[model samples]
Target: MTENRRFLLRRRPDGDPVRDDFELVSAPVPSPPPGGFVMRNHYCSIDPAMRGWMDDEPSYMPPIALDDPVRATTVGVVHASDNDDYAVGQWVMGLNAIEEYSVVTPGHFTAPVDVEAVDSPTRFLTAMGAVSLTAYFGMTDVAKPKAGETLCVTGAAGAVGSVVGQIGKIHGCRVIGIAGGAEKCRRLTEDYSFDVAIDYRGKDIEELRAEIAQAAPDGLDMVFENVGSPIMEAEVFNLATHARIVLCGLISEYNAEERVGLRNLWQLIVHQATIHGFLIADYAPRFPEGGAKIMEWVREGKLRIDEDVQEGIENSYDTFMRLFSGANEGKQILKLP
Candidate 1:
């Protein structure tokens, strides 16, 4: 029997999660039945969404059970296969626990991965995985951004934020990104080709509003909000009439014990702005179509995908906490043994 090292939730997190909240333990890998396959995990994705999963609240996805292996998306190599569809030595992406190995019976959870075509295994966690798909559908299908319109994205240096801003550009919108620091702001504008980038760190609400106004003088036609709390409040005051705000992840409020109140909600009614909260799982059926278009843009050099890869699985807790602190420059993933 194969022995695997796995990270399990020792306790549900309050505020930001710490390494002690997770317990790394060894487990005997279960033998795959007739239809199952055994996989050796190579990399695991660490996303902001995982924080939401820790809460025992109603969400787009089910919360992870306490003491269970932490739920995550992973890229792995098939080591033993009883399922003809998944051959040994082939790479695959699946919703597996953070483990050295896993046994899975494929259904809604597993898909083949072409690692070479993707540039890196981590891309499956970022551009080609749920992150890119969220941006693709949220902007294209939900927000319906048009050319010449002004699009603003928050958490703009993150995995989903970067892709959302780029997709806005592809749709011919003047794209502006809101990031946390000078370095992230510089990368958003210089590397990702955002029309403007705002650094929100140390800035008061007035300063933030002023920078946003300067960047989008006519108001924002579309807003892809990844950070919530105070930033969302500021954006509300600057929304254009009939503006569509796609509410994706709320990184800001994740650390709060209680939900932060948005003081400017009346702005939504006054400006006729529509705020829609979405999870990528809702667009599961259309993933291929969206994924194909994103890949095409990537291949044509119209979209740039970025990733901040932590070197080892042992550092997963630190890497995950980086999302809330804005320490990660791109999609955060951990390379496993």
Candidate 2:
């Protein structure tokens, strides 16, 4: 454990990334520069966004440079520090990477996490982390869901999606969740208390549209879009008048070799709908407020957050692939050994 083990990007991926696209290299643990600290990353977040970061494209965040450890949100303890703001042994979470150690300077993305404030230290990466915050701000501030309105959330069984659905219910909206499998759909209705759950697995665009239309007979009032392409295309066709669409993540197209344009763009014009692309980073200043409100909901048993934690940094590739393969159970996390 003396040498820091890093899962580094060696080459850009053509499509769905393969193991050869990355290299697990052992290097000397990075030292903190002036006004910085080094953290021994204990948990690494595995998200669909990681795929987009691998591509050399203009995005909200810069693409992961070649030969560098893949960027990720990590929760770890301060192993060494050169800053008075962050002392050694303090637990912190922020934008780091999939490496044994990370050199961090306190900023908008970096913050000390009160480990005792939550049930587990990893909660900072799950329920109280960016996942829930994304759901909170996206649902409340962006989508602006209203009572009696029909709210449809794609990838509803996911970490953010699940929370979004519950928030919709709390706001008195009729929640319709579209997930991948029978189990996930069942959980959407039973575990998350969604009004209706549509299983999108094994369904074509037409079939999925039929199911969605059936679920929301009057059309959808608000759409929290996570998966893109076919799912988005279907959701667009079923928009209610003056609908608000929160464009969160396009997970489906993240690893696609060729992107397909949505055929139902005109539906938005016809419905006079508004689609707002949302990024959690935009609300960085209010993370504390959002986190507090979300934790309150969790304590009240109004929200249920799940995390799928995999062991060993060596399993990073397989763990990350779960986001694409639909193998992950919940918020995907990688626990360092």
Candidate 3:
């Protein structure tokens, strides 16, 4: 129990992240330094964004250096602490590794969790967490969608995409969700209240585009694109004049062996459309407002959220792969014993 278990990046992944890309290793758990704490993690977040961080190239966040423990946000109970602010057994969330134990500095990567305000602890890592924040800001600030407009969301059955679609409905836009399979497409329309849904799996680019075009016969006023691939081309081909595309994620092409250029660039010019990419961290100062609104919607029964949780740190590697293969149902997370 006193030893620390960690998954270190063995090398920079080329295409898909394979199990061998990480090496499980152990070390004696270290005591917290001055103004720091040692935590026994209960859960670790597995995000698609983590894949982008695995590469050696520069990004909005730093890449994981070789041999360093893979970085992930975790919720844990304090096992020990040198900081006066955090007592032993205090619940906290912080940027920790996918390890059983972690030594975290107080401010830079750690924060105390507010358990009383939420329905459950894991909710902090779900609807009330980073995924929802990303959805909120991306839809509100950048897309800036209005009532009666047609909004199409890619990856709509997953965490962030589901949230975006619901928020679009709340704003009075007609929401269409594009998912990989028939079941997810049904969930979007039935469970998430998306007006329509399209299944992109087993369909070629042309076929998928036809489905997207059919779903949005009035043309797309805004696109909350989560799975960026040929789906982007399909969505682009259907853009209305002056449409806004919120580039939240590119899950489809994250691990592609070859980078394929989106051939619909000319459509942007033809439609006078605009696409913008954003980082959720850029809206850190507005977390209180955004978090409050999302929570309010949850309490009012206006938002629907789900999580795909796998037990144990041992399942971490396989659980992470589920995101790429579209095997996970919702927000993917790992629970540690």
Candidate 4:
């Protein structure tokens, strides 16, 4: 029997998750049934959403059950198959576990990948996976930015944030990005085509507000929010009339023991702004439309994709921690041989 190493949830975390929250175990690989296939995982994505899944609270998706294999998205190659549609040696992406192998039914997943067209096999989890889709739908469908509008995106150097800012520019909006450091801020403006980028690491609230005013003199028409809490409180002060705020991931509060409250909520009512919190899964039905458009833009050199990959499944927890510290510049993934 083939042995598979998998990470199991040891306990739900109170603050930032540590390696102790997960336990690695070795188990026998399950044999594929009549219509199932076995996959050897190549890459697995580590997202901030996983933090929300740890809590047993109401969310777009169900919480990860205690003692269950840590839930994640993975790309793997079919090693054995009983399903006619999924032949051996084909590469596929699915909602799998942080494991060495998986036994999946064809119906519960997506079609196999065409590796030749993508820049890397891991791109399936980055540009072509849920990250890109979240940026596409959240910006285009939810925010609905128009020409000459001022667009502001928080977590501006992250996987989804970088794409969000670029798409804003493509639609003729003046894009401003808020990140954690000068290096990230520089990359957003110089490399990602954002009109202005602000570093929020050392800046006081007043300085941040002034920076926003300078970058977006007309105020912000669309705000793609990825970080919540203190930063979001500042964003509320800069919103223009009728502005649309697309609430994506809230990485800032993921590690907090107590929920951080926003102080400037009155700005929302006074500015007539709309704050819409969304999960990409809600728009899964329209994923193909968003994916095709993003892919087309990538092919035409209109969009840029960035990835920070850490080798081996054992490092998954540490790589995930990078998101909170701004150590990763883009979509963070773990490679499993």
Which structure among the candidates has the greatest TM-score? 2
Q: Write the per-residue lDDT of candidate 3 for residues 82-194, one digit (tens) a residue.
A: 98899999999888889999888876547787888887788878876789989999999999979999999998999999999999999999998988888998899889999
**What do the candidate models score in CA lDDT, each in turn?**
0.86, 0.92, 0.88, 0.87
Give the lowest summed-lDDT range of ten residues in model 4.
103-112
Which digits, one per residue and each the tens of the lDDT, describe model 1 over residues 139-226?
8889998889999999999889899999998888999999887899899988899999888889888888888888888899899999
TM-score-better candidate, 3 vs 4? 3
Q: Where does model 3 exceed 4 Å of error?
A: none
User: Which portions of model 2 show Cα errors greater than 4 Å?
Assistant: none
Candidate 3 pairs with clashing backbones: none
**Model 4 scores what on Cα lDDT?**
0.87
lDDT of 4 by residue, 129-206 (tens): 899999998988899979999998999999999999999999999999999888998999888999988899887788
User: TM-scores across all candidates?
Assistant: 0.96, 0.98, 0.96, 0.96
Give one digit per residue, the lDDT tens place, for model 2 in 1-337: 5799999999999998999999999999888989999999999989889999999999888999999999999999999999998998999898999999998888879989898889898889888889999999999999888899999999999988999999999999999999998999889998999999988888899998998899898999999999987988888889999999999988888887788867789999999999998999989899889999989998999888889999999999999999988888889999996
Least accurate stretch of 10 residues (summed lDDT) in model 3? 106-115
Kindly report which residue pairs in candidate 4 clash with one another: none
Residue 255 local lDDT, model 3: 90
